[model samples]
Target: MKEYLKASSLDEALNLLSKDSQLKVLAGGTDLMVQKHAGSLSDVRFLDINALPSLKNINEKDWGIAIGALTTYRQILNSDLVLAEFPLLAQAARETASVAIQNRGTLGGNIVNASPAGDSLPVLLVYNALLELQTQKEKRNIAYTDFHQGYKKMDLRSGELLTQILLPKGNTWDRSYFKKVGTRKAQSISKVVMAALLKMNGETIEDVRIALGSIAAFPLRCRFLEDFLKGQQLPLLKREELDRLIEQNICPMDDIRSTKEYRLQIVKNLVWDFLKA
Candidate 1:
């Protein structure tokens, strides 16, 4: 009843998309297949692009590092460039589901899925990542901050496919941390997650970036908190001010996984612990 086509190349994929308005791109099929099994998608035309060579590379360029959208979590965990430059991303990848899932789930899929509890989203936000989208006509790059539109929504348009993720290549983060609180140690959705990047001069924080997930409608960057932390010494990080700031900035909703009150407390504790560390 449904048509499944394996794209022979990137061009073929784009052409298929141009022809079939209802066609969906399939990467790892980790999330898409789940939606399929749930009957959320019906009479779907799947354009399989997992084998498209243009979307399967991890390249280091003058602009920064370019990670192909099709790159799997397992590959990211094993990439030397990822380990040396963006270890938090690799750490997030390692925290994703099981080894089997990691081997199949792709970075692009995680991003496009745009789940509030996605582990990698916070890390990507911390890195100020950029996404490359391509179509039969042209290609464009969108900042990660501008990519997510709303709950389970993105800036992606019809006939366009996400091709790569670009992360700046540098040592801006002298100290970094990532933590996720889930129902279980592994294979569970996060109730609250945090990713922090700090650039310090001695004990003074010259720069800082903090991002959180599962505590909001979508992954969020705490620029206000980061601005407050900059040029401040770690020892001078007052708990009262920190708590007040978090309470003022974040208003997490009560969901099936966690309560709003619980999420707020976790945010306070995590920020306090991170500063102390």
Candidate 2:
């Protein structure tokens, strides 16, 4: 690293990023520091933004919930607003490693890291989370589903930084569920994870959103499966039909943690289990 700087405000951070495209912004340092210890960090400058108080707030907005980019996992787990309204997100927050790592892992960092196995990505995708990005010149909102481009890749531009996460009308979800299949329960990264939000009218499904992680290059919504389940009664949802739908929609790849076949099978089971439960 050529230099280290700390931004006192969001504008300061944007100014620095605009001037130096190679400057890496560090929020919690949980992921960045790991890369640094592993000698993976390239020669670049560091801009620490942990002190920016504007980026650590959690407030309810007319759109929905506004989670400042620097909000930590532990904070999310303990937040009454988050737990009551976005239980799936809070559940994902609780399952992120242990208390120690959660204290240092920011929500924005997890999204920006764009890890295939990231526990929060699927939940955000299911809720249709929106990202607030800012630069010295402009500010914009991008859908979370569109933010991720590929493995460890995102739509973030050179002179921009992620500012906040907006959950638009997500609290209106009827029933939300999140499940992660991992080596253990807590500390291990997920091999296959699913997040579902369902709104049912009596026995018929009114609206549904489903997202899966560690089954593709990036966490993605199961739109085909969602479309098939909507307006259908629970009795009409057959296991074999759901199984076929999942197999046709998802594209999983074999990796160090699990096999492609295993991920595919478990994803099918998880979707069924979530609906039944």
Which residue ranges in model 2 land beyond 4 Å of their true spot? none
Against the true structure, candidate 2 reaches a TM-score of: 0.97
Best by lDDT: 1
Give residue 28's lDDT in candidate 2 (0 to 100). 95
lDDT of 1 by residue, 148-240 (tens): 978988898889999999998766677789999988998999999999988889999988899999987799999999989989988777899
TM-score of each: 0.97, 0.97
The lDDT of model 1 is 0.91
Candidate 1 residues lying further than 4 Å off, grouped into runs, are: none
List the pairs of residues colliding in candidate 2: none
Please write out the lDDT profile of model 2 over residues 19-85, one tens digit for every residue.
9878899999999998988888866578999998888988988768999999999999999888877
lDDT of 2 at 274: 86
Task: Look at candidate 1 and tell me the lDDT of residue 18.
Answer: 84
